[model samples]
Target: MGSKLGYVYRVLKLGGSLITNKNVPFSFNEELVTNVVNVIKNFKVILVHGGGSFGHYEASLSKENTQTRTVIAMQELNLKILKIFNKENIPVFPLPGRYFTINQVLEILQNNLIPIIYGDILPNGNIISGDDITLTIAKHFHTEALFATDVEGIIINNTAVSLLKSLDDFREIRTSQFDVTGGIREKLRKIFQYKVNSLIFDGRNPTNIYYALSGKRIGTFVEAE
Candidate 1:
């Protein structure tokens, strides 16, 4: 409640696995994205999204020495998302994640415009992961971070680790996907840098998105103490 622009602010990320058919290239889940947007538009939040099939596949190809094409593909995917939010009247302003200065983001928030950014193609010919961007925003804003993923949150010993205190908490969980960026392990490490407690929840069900943002504990909260 510090600024009239943001009554309740949060740095939120929409995982690519939930917004797109990850196994298929260029598959955008418009329906699911729209549904999630409907619920999230009710709050004052900065939106960050991963490039699932869009960005990851490019990153993989670029790893083999084809970089420029990868950057273009990532930009294309970013535009697609920007259009989706704009069409819905979400009051979104788009920016490439790598070049997104904290001052720019804050100015947008100050003016009450929801900034929609994504892991973009940086000028240095590199790609930044959406999760990494979320971590940065969390630290800068000193606010809570939330990630919407495909699973039911970080699982351990056949149960969700409701309160993750350290990286050792996820020692045994295996990732079974073609992840170009570091998977869950990387996500855990990023949030830990600032000892920021973040909320990880399932985005497959739109209701879960609503519940977690409403602070009702529908998902696992990573404790960063």
Candidate 2:
């Protein structure tokens, strides 16, 4: 691991769709999120989460005060996740995705605190996806990551490839109607651009989260090459 903290380190992104029911506005997948939180409590990694039903739903409907509404929704979901981690005795600190610096994350990690961030609308009102934040942090840390999503992985012709060699391998896939940030397509573009080797796996199964974090090869591995 490239972390100076000297441990098995990685960034983990919890896909919004995995943690919430996108079709149902403000619906949270509490059981799934709780299970994931429990399984990941022992690991030392930075966590990023998407807007899912929370921010996405608000963003889709609110034409006025879009940024404020969106960020507030995202904060609500973020706090719910923090509560779960706290219940597990996991030392998690919530950080704003828009303004959090790399040094802040490093300092938190040095103190053995899990820094959790989520996708949000910037001050300029641009929607930043959790995938983008995950890749950015992973690049700075020079480490691979686990992208936990609702799907098994990148699927083409109804199957998830074990290895994604290039963006050319991708095909159009369905994304949540309320998703303001680009979905899988945007994620793959960032992955390829940053050249951060990462895994895209199903988070619906609680065991898969454990397998991915533990580096057990449970899903599609997007190659850095």
Candidate 3:
């Protein structure tokens, strides 16, 4: 919601790896989403979630589904997420990223309802990444971004680097599974381009979100300073 001080918008992208069983086709981790949402429910957030097993697995030839089918599958998962937030008495306006523009989302947030979005197949049949969703919203609103993945943070030579000041600090990133968006490297590349600092943290720990949202020094930071 807007305040006289103006809304301090934040884009929180819930990684598919954290909220879904990547190994299991179409499987969603409802509990993990619930936990993460519970911790950040109070913030001025524009929530975007990954497709996890749902989008990736469905688009796989093994699943006998194409990108169109994947779109339907992801939307179904979106409904479930809305239900979970509803259970907690949280007001969320679920938006399908492809069809909805960021300004409409601003309208929802202005009305005091959180806007929930996700990675999905667009109407033109392109796979939308959760990172894409987060970046788009962040740029439109100039908000800080947070990517919540399953891992502790971005791992470099088997170590999770806590802060990144430039791309020269790292060389490569590992894609989890069925990821069509070019993985962690792409995410880092785009987020660093923002004028605001971005963060990557483990969503499995609810407290980490609490700490991060409260502006604590947690997770890996991609400093835009």
Candidate 4:
């Protein structure tokens, strides 16, 4: 935490937990989103979000095609996020699955526009989870990747775990517990394939987000070994 403001660009992936309260009803958590935006308003950031209880849970319960329903649900949820960002004058570009790709992420970074993308089933009939998007972005653009998630960090023994300082500690945990259609462990797995630095912090805590982007130790850091 040197100056709390020297990073060139930041990529923030907002977890579903922060935006929605449990499930049902599409509404924004005003305080949480506002706090998060306030923390990083000074820096150029690309925001990505998880489906959370919005599109993912609804699709899972419905009898509709997984891909089709997921796409529609994600589009709706993305709009919700867009509305919130717009109100704050954050200048968000909502890029759905159709527009998601490594090159697209790079282009957004180059243009200095904060992109607010979400995890959704890609148009190719494949699921592109939020964690997948985070890893993809981190791999392409060597910037700090922040995961504002429901859980504080990788949990072990009912406690927050820090694999960034001890990568070997996470080896024994089952991958299933960490998978959220695409989750922290998945992000860590894909991140290990690249040289990018990543972090998993409690999305409920907006201050942690500020610290993470500022290069301070706020959450669990995941790195490639």
Candidate 5:
């Protein structure tokens, strides 16, 4: 018999909604992260989280440069996430902009260590959103990537839309309607350009992460044409 197929590697780009709350004050959704980590326990995962309610709110209020304030807030949130992951015996390697480069991401992935990154404004005076980094890392490393967002994967008419399954389906729609940070659409565009397959899923349901990691159909798949 042939050798058994090895486990596939996956990188999950988690949205801010997974950690932070808009309605709650200075609090994180620790329970949600705990639940999600439980669901993802079986996989060899590299997690990238978005700077959620806390970072966005603080950045908006500080009147400081977006890069400065956002980076500081994200660092704090990253530690919070690390604490939760540590409680579950999941080793988290925090990757901030200062420590990240394309080569660094590859090295970490090759070592099978789960690296957690987040969206933040880079010191270069540009928004280094997580979506952008996810695409870059996916292309550079030749790995699969997934985006776990609050929504049910690019919705329209209260239903989930599959933009990649049929590119023509979204050809007429304005790109802005689909992305909040202006990076989701760009991520999809890169998916097409680089011939990489990615997915957008409802992170509120932690089991969806298990399905995605298992190579089962459970989310809106974005694939290269």
Candidate 6:
């Protein structure tokens, strides 16, 4: 489904917290992920995921020599996701962040398959956040992003902001202690930096995931102006 402009790909990110229990090390929310995958099987979306309890817990253990461990942990979680997709008969393939060039992803899409990439540790020990990967592909194709997170959306004053246009709107939002990749704040920063319109919705509610993918904004819409 490419055009003279580009492929009409829906760049979606499955937040680590949405699929894994962030508080428990290496805890994968299999049932929730299975429901999410069921909804995703209907669409050919470019999928990106966070480290969550997997790589994040390992990365928090040591600053040095954790690259291999982090990658392995993230892959372990990714493999679990792959298994779900496979069981549902969805065509998906994994592309490590290190090898996640635009062309490599497009090649998978060209074959009518979905490409799944995750937040990974770069060779230099830098953490490549999943939001970074999502923005990279979404910005390239000028596509809107769908972020299925644990929260309903960006909340302020106990209410979710329907439309967010500036960073000042949620400056007080706190980042997680276990999140090595700067958490939600970092995700918002990249969204604004790339100027990619995105919907940050709660994946806890299975209906929200379906609504988001169906183009119905069920969460906070970030429009970097």
lDDT of each: 0.77, 0.86, 0.78, 0.68, 0.68, 0.85
Tens digits of per-residue lDDT for model 6, 1-225: 234335466788999888988878989999999988988877658899988999889888856679889989989999999999999999899988878899988888888888999988887888888888898888877778889998878998888889888778576455555799888887888899998899999989888877887788878999973
TM-score of each: 0.89, 0.95, 0.89, 0.80, 0.80, 0.94
Candidate 3 Cα misplacement greater than 4 A, ranges? 1-5, 62-65, 169-174, 194-196
- Candidate 6, pairs of clashing residues: none
Per-residue lDDT, model 5, residue 134, is 75
Q: Answer with 1 or 4, whichever has the higher TM-score.
A: 1
**Top candidate by lDDT:** 2
lDDT (tens digit, per residue) of candidate 5 on 77-179: 8888888878888766788755667666656656666788777765674556676677766665467678887667865556676655545454323332212
Residue-wise C-alpha lDDT for candidate 2, range 75-171, written one tens digit per residue? 9999999999988888988887886778878887888899898888888888877887898888887778789988998897899988898888588
lDDT per residue, candidate 3, 1-225, as tens digits? 133338786678888788887777778888877887788787878898888788877765555447678888788888888999999999998888676687778788878899898887765667777787787777776656888888887787788889888778676655556766767888887776655578889878999888777777677887864
As a whole number from 0 to 100, the lDDT of residue 212 in candidate 1 is 73
Better of 1 and 6 by TM-score: 6
Residue 67 of model 1: what lDDT?
Answer: 57
- Model 4 alpha-carbon drift over 4 Å, by segment: 1-7, 21-28, 106-112, 165-182
Window of ten residues with lowest summed lDDT in model 3: 1-10
TM-score of 3: 0.89
